[model samples]
Target: MLRKTESSIIFIQQLGRGLRKHADKEFVTIIDFIGNYKNNYLIPIALSGDKSLNKDTIRRMMKDTSYINGVSTINFEEIAREQIYKSITNNNLTELRKLKEAYHELKNRMGHRPTMHDFITNESIDPIVIVKPHKCYYQFLKRINEDISELTSYEQQVLTMLSLEILDGKRIHEIILLELLFQNDQVAYDDYVTTLEQLNCRTDSNTLSSVIRVMDLTFFVAAQRKNYGDTPICNLKDGAFHLNDDIRRSFDTNETFKDMFLMSYYVQRKKQEPMIVALH
Candidate 1:
């Protein structure tokens, strides 16, 4: 039940098995099955890239990329939360601290980060010790900046709207344009005043025009104008607005959106909203 320095050998072994050339083989297909299939810090680690051991490198790689699905890490469910908490607290961190150190050493020594369950299985500790209570092991990861943070509420909402915009191709621009006005990111004129009036926001045409100008510096949306130098909302040529090409491209493959979606899903299971306990 205890085998230190075996993970690295297994890692190399698996790849070596598939890497053997054959006429029937098209290419080497490496599939790492993992329960905690989330986050991107391990991308460079998997490829054995430069700065693979550096947390900054991982964060930079994560941010610059489209998305991360942690295929190499195993995620454990909370089973004996109370028992784990009790064990560590009663021990006064002597054993806990040692395990934490081992976790780091194992990562470097094993050539890959090992899961808490993996540690429990390979070491003389209870699997439930780090499996259940989140922080016992979380603090260890935080020391190394290997912890994955959850998403915020506003960011999640933005992603929802963005995803909807993508699915609703015909109305994406029109929907977001209306959303700009709804969010007060854009201004409307006489007809817009009518829209605001419908919303019970009391404002005259000139005041609305001024407000629109003040808030029109949108990064993802642009308003159309009439040839007569006036904002138009009724005429397709003058009133319709469009989404920026670059912003749309970013939305197509944004890691932030994917992270938020997963975090929201996780939180929803607990009956508490995601951002109620956001990561930073």
Candidate 2:
């Protein structure tokens, strides 16, 4: 098959036409001559029928097809595999057009506006990709002209900080402390370390201090600080960390802002649970 089609569905349909069984045919030889196309990465996505938009899964399917349910084989030349890898790396999965398409498709499937949690639960495109282009999911909805509640300038900046930095689940210390503060209004450093220990996370002094810095925006570079409006999510005083007064006020007064922040936190916590289990 000529690898000229940009649509994965069309590519898969073309491949399907040749896979029909014949009276005398034992098997069919399907040859795909890949070209230097930007969407060559979609070939594996089509063959594997994986809609996760996960590059690693695509790469794994290229490497091994033995786990496939049917008695079929997929072979890729080393050079061709490398070409697909390059395409996956260089292609912007978070481009506006792609994000909009994914959003609408998933929205249609659910018969309603899909939340970030809905995407995660459905194993659809990575919600991070949605946030990358617009800094938060609501902003992306806004860009697509979805009628949603508007966010204030301050609320928008706070969401940007959470989406860009905290919600990636690189480390859960900040999230844990933030959740604690939300529950109790303050968290002692000792209590924070104890909580990390209970979760099997690194409780080293440096790691603890780093979490504090991250929450207070001290860990970010000047440019990043400016992007987040130089706002601190937490404030430390008397050896206890408290949510920043302005932020806490926003959360207490604005139900919409509170809901968005808590939803992001819940998603991050869910993402970290697997790592926490493995640590034990």
Q: What is the TM-score of each candidate against the true structure?
A: 0.21, 0.86
Candidate 1 runs further than 4 Å off = 1-193, 218-237, 255-280
Tens digits of per-residue lDDT for model 1, 90-192: 4332344645665666677667766443443354333233322332233335555775543334333343333222222221123323444333423434455
| Per-model RMSD to reference | 19.7, 2.8
> Which pairs clash inside model 1?
37-70, 38-70, 187-212, 232-239
lDDT of 2 at 241: 86
Cα RMSD for predicted model 1: 19.7
Quantify all predictions' global Cα lDDT against the true fold: 0.37, 0.81
